[model samples]
Target: MKFLSSLVVLLLLFSCQPQKNASDYEADLIIYGGTSAAITAAVQAKKMGKTVIIVSPDTHLGGLSSGGLGYTDTGNKSVIGGLAREFYHRVYMHYQTDSAWKWQKKDEYGNKGQGTPAMDGENRTMWIFEPHVAEQVFEGFSKENELEIHRNEWLDRESGVTKENGKITQIKTLSGKTYSGKVFIDATYEGDLLAAAGVSYHVGRESNATYGEKWNGVQVGVFQHKHYFNVNISPYVIADDPASGLLPEISTNPPGENGEGDKRLQAYNYRMALSRHPDNRVPFAKPENYDPARYELLARVYAAGRDDTFEKYDPIPNLKTDTNNHGPFSTDYIGKNYAYPEASYEERKDILQEHIDYQKGLMYYLANDPKVPAEVREEMAQWGLAKDEFTDNGNWPHQIYVREARRMIGAYVMTEHDVLGAKTVPEPVGMGSYSLDSHNAQRFVTAEGFVQNEGDIGVHPENPYSISYGTLVPKKEECTNLIVPVCVSSSHTAFGSIRMEPVFMILGQSAAAAASLAIDQGIPVQELSYADLKVVLDEEKQILTQEK
Candidate 1:
């Protein structure tokens, strides 16, 4: 992910002229964002005999896949096919080799993946791994495809996309470089490129009435996870006194009534890759601007006789884990990032740094602070950041798990009914079976003065259902040539299920296949026949139907 004077390359290509022709850097398909979806899109485009290039803003290749989300959120693996399933099959193959297992023995690791074998013998799939291992697998895929990736090239949000007659002909980067393409895919979690091209997208949650969904908007009463604080714990700065101002992370505003719409977003946390082994552990360092007062709510959680903590330090391979948010005040910095989806690059960077600093400080406080429970502090001291992982970025994950962001309101919107098997979708580009899992979107002080987490729901889909091809393309009139695989067209509730990493890669492959066919037949992606698109997807081994 190291930059190789690519900015200089872009600057020279533009020649400070402030403008360039379409022929400056041309490709048949240009994929934006350096996510894992972007990797598969470029690879699939190459397989379809199209010249592909990745205009990547990230130096790191994989998004959340390589960003310590190693304990993959795979639901009903039978529905997974194409590049998405193949990635896991390759992960299984890697574990079969001695060179792949460095810190743990295969037999010692045993076999434990969500109620199924960690290594599925019949399917040749692996569902658990380390962060570094996943990154290596993605890097191997990039090298095998021999794809061109322009790293650190950010999109110029203002006046970047060049369009003619309702189609995007080319896009310009911030460095003044232009990339012309017949088709473009926006695979970023933020959907920046899609938005820059004048594609209409929706931010925040839509009301249940908007999509007739069961769980779409404000969910103040539903409590699915243990993220809610104990009712006995007060939210004031001075335990029971409202006269003292609100605590550090507590919101003073009222949580809306259930089923109402709001601008809140799910809590974001680093999926820390922690190592328990002494050889690989890097002791959690106190971050700059450390503030013990920042974790006042966390101290209250411990003092309330709540001893059961650390339930979400999910294990991966090699004595490491994909550590995530646990209790009421663990790693999730609640109600902090509502503006990130629409923020400028500089503004977004500031937000991300704030999150990084907050998380880092939390780790330090847990291991060393006197206020944290002695039992929890002792357990926290046993784990530290992996010394071998994320070597360049101070052994921390580079990509924050952006669970949901600017979802495009395209030709068709996938809803909760689509996921729960009530609405039947005819155009199947891919399939998903994950639960409607949404973290607490807001943290507010209740009527009784106790802090409570709201908007956390975890309901499973009734059956494995197909994702519509319509979700990948914008409305025909907006921008016919651009495809969005990651930030799909879906209700916030449905996006909670479809936003998983596997589905992103599946959508990426399908996007490229459809793009290739559109170029061959001289048609817009929206006008491309579902029958024809299905043919290519089937040939590429995409699972279009549920297996018996």
Candidate 2:
């Protein structure tokens, strides 16, 4: 009897181990990318009683949310609820402990965050935190939910995705690992998996007429940020000597007419984590390929008596600031990132290295160069990269902020009208209240012989508007069991508003819930009832409608 009982137990234990599919590992759901949305989606899948795995190319998880963008770009806190809000609440919980404030006392850090109370005593949500704290919180989410993430796994774009009957059956990574699932979610910033799976997507700006948007395409006359050259700065390499040709960063082509369509994308930069604390700062080191000549324009701008470089040095916890591109000729490598959207991996690496060199050189120039003003140089010398952040990349940010990438053109593309709350979204999965914001796309010489920056716009939406469920799923004919949360379907102008980190998290949870429901009903993701999805989301505390 004892031998028979042992045999039965051994058979059951072997059966419980996951049986590998002929293709790769099999699960109920497979998630791609390592963005914050990707993490949240995997967690939601785990909660929905599904076996899920994350196959990501990123060495570090939580894209910009953990990559030195500590100052939350939260438009309205009320609209952020559910697991997204839970994330912020967890950030608060981490700081509530006495030991969490290592460098500074919690009482002294008086950051009434985003013009509102950063510490909501009632809601227990913290709007502001450090990069490492945010990353730790996200990692905790992964551990508590038993979420499996296979980092550093790149998807082979060419022959990776295996589809059958208009659905992704299995996906192969460059490392030869494969994942088969009943449902899939593409949460990447680049929409690599979506495009590989044959889903239609759009890159760069669309014409205003294409979506009846006032701020969709090449914006020449409209200027919102202080990133434009104010004075009449000459565009020539030798400062008004036309025969010497244009400067290194300035483009020779025309910026095109207003409202014209173009393939140019917004500038990309690293959201730096600079610290004033001496113990926690690593002084800026010049890159191996640093060229001081690259910053000639910024020097000229400073020479013209523009000292607003410190305007965007917004402070976060532990005496660190989320240093962003402030003035014209700042760290925004304009017109250089146009090829990034469709560039090959090698080409993309080159582009990313260029940005890093440019930004790092900018810091060294501001701190140590003789051309910088003495007072400004002295002030900048006090700031350096935070010692405890992004240690894998020499204390710099691991991820460059890819503000916009390939947006899927799914069954319903949310337009500017939807952004401005002029039209109603059919099914409410999330809400975005941030401004329709895009950084400069191209920097060129105007007809007046002055260097100017183009493609920056900031139009505030009227209220927190709902995001649609259709935007998450592809067209019924395109794919049946896939959902895209990060690279959602929307026009360029509308995506500007919908691309906030909080909104991405909200959409991630909603997409996972939809995926679970589709699996339960044994139907396509697009065929899953929005009414049923809403009930699940509501139970999970997702604020589909705007909060009062």
Candidate 3:
């Protein structure tokens, strides 16, 4: 009788206490991505005294910034401010130490950059660095801020998002984990969370007419870059034979009207980090699906006397090169990633593997194939994947260069006129000055029976233009508390200029500021006053407009 009375008293005491769920996963701000923007956004949110959590689909942080694109595309570096500029300053500080330069001395690099010195002492910024160094800096930012990151957590796109009166209450991942937050920021390259949340976005190019833009649509003959085929190459398997089928990778469909819209996406590739130093180089291994016939057109390109294979082997800090797409058939896998934006996770993995196989096979063929020119092959043979970078991913970059993806149709759509500074941007939050640079969308057989690359446009903006705060805000009716920075509201032409790593970081910080302010004032992101947002942004040292 005594033991039963004690047990009943214990049960009653436990029931009266508050229940705590270990799996609650609640926070003040929830950021979805592992890009450079994600890092900056989380840092800004945490700085504003918000309990923030980063749910990243990527195993590695820093996106392309650490994934072999160490050569920063910084236009008018003076306009770069806030956390974005701080990131570059951190790179400069890292290189100042003797231990940072392992393979080569700092003096040998000669401070080469995109029309500016790679390492500027006066400005205290470094524009070029190694992939591992970039990753270290980004990781340092997270560690210093004590930010919590859940890596490799992919969103369950089908039914993960739970909305209460147009605002996201919480999101669930594929692992059956749920995260609740007052505000959410989608900073992914693919805009995965934004799309899963039923936000309206565009998948491909908007017609010039759709946005009153000059460089938005099908650019069949506008070959501004060296990516187009300079020499006339026949598209048929048997040269000039109509009955013969088209060559591999050459689309049979028409290249489309000059300025009309299409669902084509720009090329995608891994910005390879290669080293010629024998001690740190790993030879390119042939892929399991290697086919010599796949590169027959490349051999033909060699026959046409184009030896510009190493044109874009831009040097970085540690005797390594950030090798990007150069010639007509170098690296950008044209016409291959059209479905990546809207693809399921499993389907996207398959597409990613295909791209990996294609690029890996290309490197092996270029270095080993007898059909390639002896000089070209010998030069290529000297270069191989960097042994020290991407240590976990077989020395290959983990993140593929996703130049463009789903762009949100949000509070305001930035068009070409805005990018060119013809129409003034209202409520400025950041600035971008890079040219409208788009890679080829298709390698198709032209009407003249010649193979040609289309949809490569490079139109420079007249001046550094301000980006409006509206670009980051979703339509109030769609979702009030959500903010998107990486895939902001912009047309294809405008995105070309805004899609830089520095610009993404800038907008990310701005987004978090708006989110923090909205949460504090109990207002939607769209309804937050620009005056209040600008005051905070100015205090944070963000360059919102061109300085007089």
Candidate 4:
């Protein structure tokens, strides 16, 4: 009887050792994002004959590509080669068929139809499309590659799992499921994976003295755009009267010492998705806490007969517009999102909803309020929420424009010298040509007591500049096993141009290629020779030089 009992215990112990099933868990690469870059990286990994999976926190596949802002910012489109170009090509293909335009007829819409290719096949530049069409193109890529995707899987960012040698052995989700992989790419805008891996990163603006950059922080005297007070607009109940109580949105803090540093972050607002389709349009509804007093400054502007209030509704596709924050007081929820960078998920959610309410309420006020100028109200009424888009979230954008977030202090720190055409980089992975664009950082009382905005830089890049691989790699001591394509280390000004979506896609593909090569060559990603990486990038059709 004792011998039989020991035999049973041995059988159970042998069965308890978990066997690796062929289908249960396995992959050559695991990507942690659902942004456009994340999709491109996963697709590239699969194309290279590696098994890959995308674990995204978003329910949707494409990030801002589908989340409105479809009016692409493709500066130096020729530099956008590789998978990024393929994405636009696919968008062109989608519109080639007449059926793609179901709502509007091809002849009626003419050459300017929805999802139509803005790029001449030979020109190598395209920068316009519909939101749904961008989503469809991303979907097509996923389907053609047959990539495995798990959406809405938030990473257990704090102490969930790790290996002894700084490798991410397993990443558990909020639901307690674990995903293990040999190689990982953090394509997220937040750099959550990279931060969790103990990588050094920075939130808010960095001091100019830290990097010797001209446009690093506290840009008080530099007003390059018309976003601030061209003419004094009062924030008080009585125009130019200081004793009538302070204005609702104006910040009381003194604009920090010029060229000095502060913790102020660039403003964030929803890139509203609106359409003219009468059947599909949901007219802006008055928000629950709609206060007419919140828009008193706007009314003051209108009362002063500023006719340019509606000029900011930039066009997108199919009679839609990617409306942005324009003028002194617009869609930007000033002073409300200072803590968004390191905020928890629940806190972030609250911030997002607050922005939604503020923006929606602003629209409702413009369209319905009798106090608004007749011309402004008429123009506002013409535009409404795009009835067919973002069906899940009530026709509003799902993602907030996180303009600047936790920037990884990586191997290569790109500074103003690179963007100002003063110095050239030795190793180039991609190129950025957009101006050093940053929206307002704070709204303050001007010298004369009227409220004004500061920190809006639109300086053009002196020339097309190259992005280095060092910008993607972390310090060896920080984390050797991670690659960060998004949230790369750079001077605040340089990052402005590199933050575009197409550039992110280009970097994503390049990061994946480097990761695969590192795995094959048995070396850390930082140790891989640039010559070899350049060869693969060139062969893969990635544009490395402006002259090319």
Name the best candidate (by TM-score): 3
Q: List the residue pairs that clash in candidate 4.
A: none
Predictions in order: lDDT: 0.88, 0.88, 0.92, 0.80
Give the range of the ten consecutive residues with the poorest summed lDDT in model 2.
110-119
User: What TM-score quantifies how close candidate 2 is to the native fold?
Assistant: 0.95
Q: Write down the TM-score of every candidate.
A: 0.95, 0.95, 0.97, 0.93
* Tens-digit lDDT string for candidate 4 (1-548): 99999999999998999886443455778889999989888887887778888889998877887778777777767678899988887776766677777566545542421233464455433466678888888888899999899888898877755765766677777866677777788989888888788889887777889878888788876878767766778877887788887777788789887667677778888888787777767899999999988888888777766667766666655667777888877888877778887888898899888888888899999898998988778877777998888888888888778888778899998877887777777688887877888888898887778777887888887568889999988887776667888888887777888889988899998888888887777777778899989988898798877752
In model 2, state the lDDT of residue 173.
92
Measured with C-alpha atoms, the lDDT of residue 6 in candidate 4 is 100
lDDT of 3 by residue, 98-155 (tens): 9998889878876789979999999999999999999999999999999999998989
lDDT: worst 10-residue window of model 1: 15-24
What does candidate 1 score in Cα RMSD to the true structure? 6.3
RMSD of 3: 2.0
Candidate 1 lDDT by residue in tens digits, 174-261: 9888999899999999999889888999998899989888798999878777878755788888888999988888787899888978
Candidate 2: lDDT of 338? 80
Ranking by TM-score: 3, 2, 1, 4
Candidate 2 stretches greater than 4 Å from native: 1-23
* lDDT: the better of candidates 2 and 3: 3
